[model samples]
Target: MPHDLNRLFPLRPARVHEVCGPSAMSFAAIASARAQGDFLWIREGWQPDTLNPVALSEMADPARLLIARTANQIESLAVAEEALRDGAIPLVVIEVTRPLDLREGRRLQLAAKNGQTTGLCLIPEGMGSNAAETRWHAAPLFDPGGADSTLMRWEIIKNKTGTLGFWDVRWNAAAHRLDVVSPAGE
Candidate 1:
């Protein structure tokens, strides 16, 4: 059976979703790369790590990426909310170092709904407490026997639809997107 990403993951538009774990950034990148057209990615200025253009090119068109760096977490959230409310971008991704409170999460939810845009929040592992449409936990899957180290394990920790599952996925360079290698039995 074909593992349709949209059907398997089902990231609803006009809602904010959460991605947490060691490879949360990668997982968020994969989602953005799969989306059509350009996207906005917001990060804190304090974050020393920068998004690699070449690396992003593997799954997404780096030239279409628009990045915004905020001076701090508060600024980052503000920018994200504004971008999300603008309804111009199809996808808005925000990397947050701290957990989002209930009020903050509600604000994002309203913004996304108003703009009809999808928001992806990259959070630290085990630090999610938001009203997200779905919450995903991603981690690198070690496969010493395999040559590729990009393999990842993903689990749906929370879903509004009440669907929960896990899968082993990897970036298909040839396909220019993520592919589910196998739907691990829950």
Candidate 2:
């Protein structure tokens, strides 16, 4: 079950989470679905058209989404930091092109801790150093079956614990949940 899967790697309330790789957006949607309440999405200059209201409506409630558009990564992070302070927003997703060093990363972590919000950074490959408690790599897999659900792969590249692994997850749109299709995709 999704609940059982979540227990293995639940998102910490006061921590920075990173979703990266070729298909970071897909992973962000999956992570967002697991969140409890409304969220704030901060889009850097790199992704202006990625925030489609119609598409978001399918994955999440468009009305509950609060968007902050910034000209640069610094500005986007600033907006995210402030939004993270609001405890009402359980999740804050930030899209950035560049990597974040430890110092700046610490600030984000602290803000999340103070507001008890979950911070998720959606970035592309070669992000260099990341201070997130957990780092994930997401990609889509070819599903010849053409199943109703989307078949995706998730790799826990880095985490607080020493646990490292990957899995094949199915995005069941009808149920609005992620199910473990295969462990390790072996």
Candidate 3:
């Protein structure tokens, strides 16, 4: 994790974490950018939302991304699990459209731990009662045209390590990193 992210969200290595809400992908991308080395990203093949290379390049080298497009949710999970288990990549992010069952979550968790890699699941809706190390909900704080367009809020809804809180943050485009505006309800 990057120094700035470590301060707000200290993620444990060799564990699976979840990111929920509409901005989940963006949040995941930002975190992945901070992470070192090449990474694998698994997403549904039919999903309309495509990642923009230009936007991604602002945070990190876009060429370092290894993308895997799957036919369905099941395939996505399978690919993610296999990638995590391989332990070659430093980070693995999967776009999950459905909630993961306990067994599925646990499998991913174990794979991550065994491989000594970090896994981030982008869940459209929050995953419930799973083996994830932490669950974060991310949302934009304002519209793009607004004065605080870059502002966003990330809430740590669940954590196995006992840390819980939310922070108002903004992306510093020039700095290519997240800047904490305020620690909400700390």
Output the number of the TM-score-best candidate: 1
Q: List, residue by residue over 72-183, the lDDT tens digit for candidate 2.
A: 8889888888888767899999987788988888899999999999998987676835578888888888776676647777888877755777778787777877678754
What's the true lDDT of residue 95 in model 2? 87
Least well predicted 10-residue stretch by lDDT in candidate 3: 1-10
Clashing pairs in 3: none
> Per-residue alpha-carbon lDDT of model 1 for 57-146, expressed as tens digits?
887888889999889889988999999999888899999898899999989999999999999999887778658889999999876546
- lDDT scores in order: 0.84, 0.77, 0.82
How many residue pairs clash per model? 0, 0, 0
Give per-residue lDDT, candidate 1, residue 180.
74
Tens digits of per-residue lDDT for model 3, 10-105: 457899999998778778778887788998899999989799989888776889999999999899989988989998998999888888899999
The 10-residue segment of model 1 with minimum total lDDT is 1-10
Worst 10 residues of 2 by lDDT: 1-10
Q: Estimate each model's TM-score.
A: 0.90, 0.88, 0.88
Candidate 2: clashing pairs of residues:
none
When superposed on Cα atoms, how far off is each prediction in RMSD? 2.6, 2.8, 3.6
lDDT of 1 at 152: 93
Better of 1 and 2 by lDDT: 1
